[model samples]
Target: MQTEKVTQHIINWLKNYALNARVNGFVVGVSGGVDSAVVSTLCAETGLEVLCLEMPIHQAASHVNRAQEHISQLKKRYKNVRDAKTDLTPVFEEFKTEVSLEGEQAIVDMALANTRARLRMTTLYYYAGLHKLLVAGTGNKVEDFGVGFYTKYGDGGVDLSPIADLMKSEVYKIGEYLKVPGSILKAAPTDGLFGDDRSDEDQIGASYPELEWAMQVYNEGKTEEDFTGRKQEVFKIYKRYNRANKHKMIPIPICEIPKNLK
Candidate 1:
């Protein structure tokens, strides 16, 4: 990818969207990952107001530190960039408790983690509504469509997806061009959703590079592959992820009315 050209292209898209929508600014939830860093920087480059929120729900200190560092750098570099930290742990705990109370069993890990994301989503849209800014999404091509790792209507909820077309590896390339902090640029990618500091790969079953390759093969209609060893297993895993998350990745099925009934 052409770093400079891609950078300018995204900036133009942001500006045009804001102008057409009559929104004065952008609201991005920064997770201290390459995707967020690159996207927030691109929004800042548009010379429009950018509100970056560091929302931690029982977050790790290291993740918080990286978020602070990235926001600090953006604030220094761009006058329009504004950032703040919000801890949603209490809210999430209460929400989880209420949900579990409805049922005898406690909330499951996946359900509990999804609540954290939806809370952050609510926070971002709150600021967006108050400030009249669009909610910018940080999802990349690989995770957005490859495995559907994001929670539906949670982190997946956004006004626009700037990097949704670019893969995770491509996001890193743009991060380098944008001078994103080395600490964050080199750090492993994580959603920072759960208490355990599990990297994206830890949950995805393969590295981003490997997943990207598998995604390419899947997209290319090249399904005939050996499924013997670890490498082949990775490809098969990718196919499973794609099939499972297809629902979240596509539009919800709607009931169609028959003309005769009408």
Candidate 2:
């Protein structure tokens, strides 16, 4: 589908969902990544009130700056766009202290990093409830379903998703068509979870493009055809991540009731 058509379809989808659910607007966490940028802009295009929130929890300065720039542009272009921000550093620090124990600093950091995402989720819900809006998620296809890179019940927890069907590259295409800032389009994608400031590529072991290719090949049932070099390397990486994150992508299992008992 063309970028414009896809964008319009998403806008219409969000509108119809809100109408059916009886919500007045959309509340989205603007993480300054391409997915969030595109999703927030699409929310604004629906002509409903959109609360674009910047909830930074000791996030990288560059990521926070990009988020602010995108929000400013949205506010200028769309009157319904509302810019809001809440710094979660203090909350994160307090949680860190509460979770701290001797000789477990690395474990503490790992748990706390995920806590940041959960905290952000809580903040978004607080604003959404106050404004009577649906929480719009920013995760794209590859991250949401393919690799499951998001924090479960964190960024993964949402009322609705606008760009979850599109791949990362497709999201960039829509973002460009929507006139996302040139700087943001060029900026490296990061989840802003780790304090080391690593990009998504650094954590994922393959670029988005590479991961997309691997997903396509896997879906095509070409996993058994082995090859050497980067293709083989990407295939391996994809399998590892996809398998490790399968739980996150799937629904929680439940025991089936016995027919006699039913």
Candidate 3:
């Protein structure tokens, strides 16, 4: 489907679900990237109350600034746009000390990255509870669902995902259709976990387009086709996340009792 139509469908779905569930509004984390921008726009179009949170750590100033600009534009365009900003440096530092993390810089950086994501989720859930809102997840199919690029209990945890099926390229198209700011639509997508030198694609070692193609092939049961020349690598990444994070995606296992006993 076209990106615009996909966005409209998502907006309608969220609106109906929110109304039926008696939710007061929708809360979304705005990371100054295309996916979140598109999700925020859809939430606004649904005529539901939308809250955008800018949670930035020490290395995310550029992303935070862009996010602020996007939020300002959203306020002008949408009637019920509310925003909040919080720096996550203190929270990350406290987490590091509490966890007693002594290791390589790469390990420390990854831990800090996950900490920032969890902190943002915590803030979103706190306000969602206080205001009776549903937290809107902003992960796209190519990232969170395909390769499990998000942190398990961090960005991966949410009340609902409005754009979990769309790929990264499709997200950019939706951003354009929504008339999101050009700068935001064109900006390089990043988690802003590390400094400017770090990026999602860089860390993953594969671009979203390639990943999406592989995902499509895999979903179609064409696992043997060597589309990207990294099929084994992709499979390994997918399997590792699926195995290590099974708890995140499934119900808690419990010992089964005999039916006769009940």
Segments of candidate 3 deviating more than 4 angstroms? 195-197, 224-262
Better by lDDT, candidate 3 or 1 = 1
Output the lDDT of residue 89, model 1.
Answer: 85
Estimate, for each residue in 1-262, the C-alpha lDDT of model 2 and write its tens digit: 6888888999999999998999889999998888889989999998998999988887888888888899999999999998788988888888777754567777766677788899999999999999899999989999988888899989999999888899999999999999999878999888898755699899889999999999998888887356678899999888889999999988899999999998
The digit string of per-residue lDDT tens for model 3 on 1-262 reads 6765777788899999999999987988898888888888899998989999887777666687778889999999999989987777787777777786778988877777777888888988988998899989988887766777787768887988888878888888888889988888767778876756366777777777767866776777765435445776775555555456556655668999999999
* Model 1 per-residue lDDT tens digits across residues 59-137: 9888888889999999999999999778898888778667654433335776777888899999999999999999999
- Off by more than 4 A, model 2: 101-107
lDDT for 94 (candidate 1): 79
In candidate 2, what residue range of length 10 has the lowest lDDT sum?
A: 99-108
The candidate with the higher lDDT, 2 or 3, is 2
Candidate 2 Cα lDDT to native:
0.89
Task: Give candidate 1 regions above 4 Å deviation.
Answer: 101-107, 224-228
- Each prediction's total of clashing residue pairs, residues at least 3 apart in sequence or on different chains, is 0, 0, 0
